[model samples]
Target: MTPEEAVTTRASRRSPRPRADAARNRDRIVAAARDVFVEHGTEAPLDEIAKRAGIGNATLYRHFADRRSLLRAVVLLIMCRVADHAERAAAETVDSLTALRRFVHDAVDERVGAVCGLLIDGGGQDSAEVAVQCRRVEATCETLMDRARHAGQIRADIGLRDLVISMSQLARPLPGIEYRDADAHRHLDLLLDGLRVPAPAACGAPGGAEERSVTYTEHAA
Candidate 1:
């Protein structure tokens, strides 16, 4: 090929690269926004997220039209991650109880509770999106519950709807309660215990019987 033609071809290839980079930067911004929102709640400033993502306000606005748009993106991203975690938990874990526990913990501690706070605090402005995300979360929970029930780890009579409602109800930090990982696990242990089927005599003692229950004396502000 002629030198001029070769140069033009290279320039054309390089031109789209910047657009790809811009797209990646937008994704990074959204991811950073999700983390910030989860940590600081939905009221977290967009400027802070842009700074954290190493992007400018204009760049962030260029990708996300408004605060609601950004929040929607964050919610969708979290839902997708939760779904992926669910699929992995279902496929990889040999122990259905373990998978169910992991799924519940991930949803409560890592995703659902966090997002639900944001949505509630946002005054349900994005109720439609929130509903969709909730359904996805419920589906994941159902999958785990089904596996646990089939394995006889969870009580066979427990319905997915009941399990989902229980998880949601338990996800919230009680009034005046200080939320902590250890505390969360303690509560989860109780819930798991309630779900568990009674072991046969040959199985001997049950697991987590000696674990201390978390005291939820305070409500989270």
Candidate 2:
């Protein structure tokens, strides 16, 4: 091939390369930001995320304009995953109570706790994008709560706001507290009992009697 033709061919090949690299860099930044933020909360430094991503700060800023921008991106990414989980839960479970229980169980993990902690710490002083993501999460939770209530899996008296608040509280990981999966399951079982209708009658015995019980115990943290 001629020199000029070779040069032209190389240039054409290189032209799309930077765009691909940029795309990859953006993905790396997002992934790294997610890991860092989840580990250190949203207050994690962008420089740390850049370093973890193996990219320069300038590149990170070029992709995400500011901390808030990066935070919003992370929040949206998490919310999208939550939405997918909700969809899957809805489809797979026949019982709304089971679905709600599964959803809460899935959310009580470290990753969800980190996200919830970040938002709670941020409080009312959040960026517009964060606010939007919050609203989306709220809306999704409301829909799930409504479905659960409609299916008689939740109390009619409990509002979506109350459920949302309860979810946030339950998502918190208490320090010095040894929480086991069985404890979580027990908590969920108690919550479900509170939503249950009157117990059904016993059968197959003449002296059968229903026993109503409510017990509360405190555990050390």
Candidate 3:
């Protein structure tokens, strides 16, 4: 089974293990919901998701029962993927900055910000599994930030929230500024470059990058 399938099963752990075909259908539905929700918010028609999954409306209803259950599954799906990316990035590299950038860029491809912003006020956010996934993301981000800060790669004043908020906003699509056409990675390069303090020359003073926010920790808090 795919990692996503594993997460989908875990999200519905209370339910009996579905038959192989039914499990495959559930996985496809949740994966489709993730993409459809990103493209058309949580209020998007159930037909759209069903069509995207190449399934009928009845099948979708059989698996999800209602929109709220589907929404919860989709949220858990994205959150679990986000946490997975963070963990994989850390495991694949010991370079803290590189790992952090990898995680952020992978998250951008997932279009987490758009889905999350739309569902921010939704009841799905209250899911116990959602909170667990969120905590995993936060913990990984914190570890990466601390390592990067100690190595003088990222700014000392920048907290974990700065990195979190940056990833979210960069992935969010704006009017006439869809993510696929924009230089989102380039913009991330700019923001990340801004976060670094320049190394000192052999006999000169170290220079600081232009900061965008000096109070994000408190402001976000």
Candidate 4:
């Protein structure tokens, strides 16, 4: 090879990645920030985040120059994860309604609803990248909804907004009530059941509330 090509190849090889430990610390900080935000809202102290991450304030500041920057990282991280889950649910699950159902359950368990509520109240999309990730997640959700709707699996009345509001409501922890994942899931199932289109009235019979109350799994069958 020519000397020029050799120098180019060496330069490419010399391009550096972050040190492994530094990268790991940043990830840990992002994760801890997410949990702390969920528990204490976006305005929680940066020191709390550093404490949760088991890192020094200096280290946290080294990774993120300020609270807004750190919050931005947390927001991007959550949205990215949500986007991945949505994409996976769409591609890997054969049955559209089942896929949607699985995605909703997984999202709820992820505390996505809670995180969103917190963000809405105090924080928001801090960067253009966050907005892009938000749209990506929404688009995947829309695709899932459209597929289920087209298949007559979910009700035509419900749309993405309805589903999101339902998720947000279910994700909230009401005052004076103990929070349990099981309870959240059970309520979510109810909402999902409400979103399913009831079977057509048999031979012009009335479509009653009882019919509408059937489990989504049974209706899917």
Clashes of each: 6, 0, 0, 0
User: Is candidate 2 or 3 superior in lDDT?
Assistant: 3
Q: Residue 219: error of model 1 in Å?
A: 27
Runs off by more than 4 Å, candidate 3: 1-16, 121-123, 199-221
Q: Give residue 219's error in model 4 in angstroms.
A: 18
Better of 3 and 4 by lDDT: 4
Give the least accurate 10-residue stretch of model 4, judged by summed lDDT. 200-209
lDDT of 1 by residue, 91-186 (tens): 764577777766666666555555556555552445676566567767776877887787778798888767656666666566676776656655
Candidate with top lDDT is 4
> In candidate 2, how many clashes are counted?
0
Predicted candidate 4: what Cα RMSD to the true structure? 5.8
Per-residue lDDT of candidate 2, residues 1-221 (tens digit): 99999999999987755578898999899778877986666778889999999999999999988776676666656655665666666666456665665565555442454566555554223566556655665666667777877876567887766655565555554756776645654554455455544422432223222231221121111
The residue-by-residue lDDT of candidate 3 on 77-170, one tens digit each, is 8878989988887786456776776677677766678656646647366788888988998898788778888888888999877877887787
lDDT of 4 at 35: 88
lDDT tens digits, residues 99-213, model 4?
A: 8877787777667775575456434555788888889889999999999999999888888989988887888777678888767766766667667777444312322334433
Using TM-score as the measure, the top candidate is 4
RMSD of 3: 10.2
lDDT of prediction 1: 0.69
Q: Looking at model 3, which ten-residue stretch has the lowest summed lDDT?
A: 200-209
Cα error, residue 111 of model 1, in Å, equals: 2.2
